[model samples]
Target chain A: MPQIAISADSYAAQFAAVKRTAPLAGPLASLRDDAFHCFDRLGFPTTRLEEWRFTNIAPIVEVPFQAPAASGGLDREVLDALPLPRSGAPEFVFVNGSFSPDLSDPSGLPPGVRVRSLAASAAGGAGGLDVLTAHLGRLARFQNHAFTALNTAFLRDGAVIEVDGGVVSERPIHLLFASSSAPAPVLSQPRVLIVAGAGSEVRIVESHAGAGDVPYLSNAVTEVSAADHAVVDHYTVVRQADAAYHVGNLAVRLGRASNFSSHTITAGGAIVRNEAGVVLGGEGGECTLNGLYLGNGRQLVDNQTTIDHAMPHCDSHELYKGILDGRSRAVFNGKIIVRLDAQKTDAKQSNKALLLSEDAQITTKPQLEIFADDVKCTHGATIGQLDPDALFYLRSRALSKAQARQLLIHAFAADLLGHIKVEAIRRGLDALLLERLPMSGE
Target chain B: MLEIRDLQAGAGERRILNGIDLVVNPGEVHAVMGPNGSGKSTLAGALAGRDGIEVTGGSATFKGQDLLDLDPEVRAREGLFLAFQYPVEIPGVNNAYLLKAALNEVRKHRGEPELDAMDFMTLARKRMSLLDMDDALLNRPVNDGFSGGEKKRNEIFQLAVLEPSLAILDETDSGLDIDALKTVAAGVNAMRSPERSLIVVTHYQRLLHYIVPDFVHVLYRGRIVKSGGKELALELEEKGYGWLDAEPAAATA
Candidate 1:
């Protein structure tokens, strides 16, 4: 791979400072050491790699970012003013990669359910630390992913969700990661680990937002494991500031007959990239990955997904839609792999983008590799402007040109929005999208 | 209410509507009938201001205003409506939502207050029943997964709801069965008023028997070859378009 000359000395210094401050004494420390060595060797990924061909992280590597320090003089008003849904669910708030107990409300959680900060879990002695070490770095492999390696090396605080067997929590879990501006460009690594036991069901909504227009970087990784017969609904909403950069990764593994679904909604960020990977390791597992991205004003949004059907009778459905305007760019790459023993693996993937402006651009790739003869796989990508006939039809009914375009664009995104079962989140996103639509005057 | 004088239009380089002349006063229903590819749909498309159907020459005036100069929505706001031959399906757009938006826009243009959701639903339900349409169709997406007959009925339903001053029905009878044709024709007849006019464009003479247009003009090769009373439809259906082609000059005169 063609490697860029990233500032290795700066990253090493930052890593040393973080390691010196928050030293873990056992296996977790060793894990961090290993990940640091891997990240040091690999550095930042370049466009030469096959997977990173479309998204270049040169901007991320070039920035001289320091590890985010503990935010002082917390902006309680700003955190409360965020446009998150007040769905009566437990919320865990993190600022600059560290959990804020004053801002979080983790009360009223169900019996046998554990929701706490990873730092608190690590410091609370043996029982919780065992849960953290068991599944923290297992599902999210950092071997080939340079960002994931870097995130693991500096991961100090995030959310840890553990739902005991046979318990289905009625309330959804909300994790809010808010970043504030610093003197220098800040880089925060937030990690999340979710373990849904057998027959347990839970919903989690993770959101990342920046407080100001200051340039910052948010590198986050979330790992989820749904045991047999468990159901998990996971959502990630990224709304960073205009001058910020975000790179997020989601890795999920499903057990036999488990059901897992993820919806990633990206609306803001100057440069944003999301990678989601799902592995159906057991038979009869089902997974659905849905995403919606809106790019405007020279913004860049990229989504990459890989679904692996490792066993027979598993199914996966993926649909990603993007709306680009004002010289913006987007990329969607979906890959589905059906192993040799994965028979009757029904998989479908579709990526559709609406380019509202002449300068807007999108590159979509839907790839499928099936080894089993009995498998059913279909993939399609469509990139087009609004349908002229449909536009005329709406106009013929007295809708103005602007109104008709807005209606059709909203309709194009309604299907993906319908997949969000959380009523509050769905409604919130609907309003946000409508408000962000490019005005006709522009 | 409407006048088209020597109207010439076409798609791309091919001329479709060549020097077409027609006129309709208030309270009149004129049926423009023709065989396939006789530019009947092209006339409707031109009137509706569809893209690519360039108006090469002549003029079309609606209620003393230059119709060609206005946008399609502007024309609709000024009380002109075209019931499409094949209504486009817009998935995920609720039929009721689309109609409400259209109704509000037209109402706003006419200096009337917009209807709230309850008021609009009541009005829409009344019109739906007049057209014998199921209530479930309004909750679904616009024409999406609808049968051909359902789509046609939806056009008429929209007409009832919008209640335009001049309604242009372009081949609305092509995809309907006998019962559906009767229902659609009855719906059209119900909307007839002294202040309103209708242009019922059809390929077959069967629809005229139900609505009974005041004038029937045969559009052949981009021109009206014959114009007569409703009986002309019966004559054309009996003798076929071949007779008109056999004596084009005499028929035009």
Candidate 2:
């Protein structure tokens, strides 16, 4: 795969702006410098790279997007109506990559659980400073990914959640990184780090939603670490505005006997790339990755997932679905790797796409590498329109042709919602699909 | 009421239902029986407006309107229903939703008020119980992962809930055991009224003993070869349809 040539001049202006607005000392400042230099060395990807062959990020790279201002002038009612943010759940809101304490609520967090601002925690001699520095930027590699490098270079504020050993959080944590832009196109890079300690269980919902309709870019990075015997359920929802651009990366690691599952839903974006990498680093661990992407009106959603089984007695299951309407396009590239020592590893992957129009399209590729002899790995990809039999069946039940089509489209998405655990998230997804699935100009 | 005047149709290049003319009055049970490849299913498909069958000639009228000219759903809302021989399995769509939406569509066409979820569920449960169907099946996806008997029972359950004026059963008792057949027949029998009509299509003469003209009509090679009273089914069962193939005059019926 050929790489894009990145000169220092590409990010020189943004790097200078970051240094002037917010400069850090100690390991933080050095980490930022290294990440910036790495980003400068390895610039934005082009279609030449095999991973980005189908999705072009030129729309994002061409625009000169300055760092966003504060999240002011947004209607509280409008902000309240974003759907991804739930009431009565411990909520944390971030505007344009800056943490908004006024809009956040962590009132009901139980004992041994803490939600702290990543920047504030990084700045002071924080209570969890060692934990932050140890795991931050560790799982998500910046050496090859320019987006991660850029996110790290500008990652001064985000949400850091820690579940102490033996703690169980009953309430799901909702982190809404709402972005609004008006005067100029801005770029918001938000980072989230979650550390679930030994024997602890936690659920987190990280949503990056566009609060305004103006054209902007949102690049987010989230890292989740599950210790021995810990359980973590994570959800990442990215529903941007019509003209917005988005790229979200999630990196997770599971320790011995830990269970980790992540549900990713991408409803709206002009050009969206969702990348998730999970590694089973210890024996007897189980990991599940579920995703559904809905696109319409020239929208392109690219999903890439990697499940790495590094130890024996590990199992991983991945299922990703896509619904494309109008002239939109979708791509799924899932890679699963089992190391030489990882015997008794069972893995299954399924990627299915439903095209609802003549111009809609999908491209899927599955890459699996298993060195172990006693491993079972299987994968299948299906691309099809709404089943004619199902459509006829529904229509024969007195549903109109349009209603039948919508029901099948809704069924394609509701099938994925059955796997989503959070009630609020499930309701939000239902509302999102109801709002977006009818965009067919027919 | 349905009136078919020399309806000719087929799947593709091969013609089936060649000059099929039948009139079904209200409060009547007409059994259309035939051997395999005799257009029993083709007739059902053609009448239901299924795309597989292309009508080449003739016409069908239902309730004083042109049935052949309407869409499948339109025909359905106009009180026409066809119980499929091999019901399609649709996942992620529950039976309650399907039946409720279907019932609402029919009711809406009749200018009747729609039923809410509670009222709809009550109606669905009552109808399902009458068919001996499990209430859990109402919440399950439409015939998905269901047994053959269960699938057939679900079809009757939907018919009972939708309350169509003309119900066409195309081989409804093909794969059913004796008990399921009785339960299904009882369900169908329970819905019989002076204002409703039935066109029971099957190959076996055994089903009529339970639902019992259901007038028996023997179809062969896409045409009705014989039509008679209830005693005809017993004679066909005793002598078999091979006797009809031997007779040249039987095709004129």
Chain A superposition TM-score per model: 0.96, 0.95
What residue pairs clash in candidate 1, if any at all? none
Give one digit per residue, the lDDT tens place, for model 1 in A337-405.
999999999999999999998999998888888888999999999999999999999999999998888
lDDT of 2 by residue, A123-180 (tens): 7665656767798889888988999998988767888999999999988898988888
Question: Which predicted model would earn the best lDDT?
Answer: 1
Ten-residue stretch with the least lDDT total in model 1 chain A: A433-442
For candidate 2, lDDT tens digit of each residue in B113-146?
9999999988888888899888899889989999
What docking class should model 2 receive?
medium
DockQ of 2: 0.77
> Model 1, stretches more than 4 Å misplaced?
A1-6, A72-74, A80-86, A432-442, B251-253
User: Where does model 1 sit among the CAPRI classes?
Assistant: high
Which number leads on DockQ?
Answer: 1
Query: Over the stretch B153-241, how does candidate 1's per-residue lDDT look in tens digits?
Result: 99999999999999999999997999999998888898999989999999999999898999999998899987999999999899878
Q: Estimate every model's Cα lDDT from 0 to 1.
A: 0.89, 0.87
- Candidate 2: lDDT of A298? 86
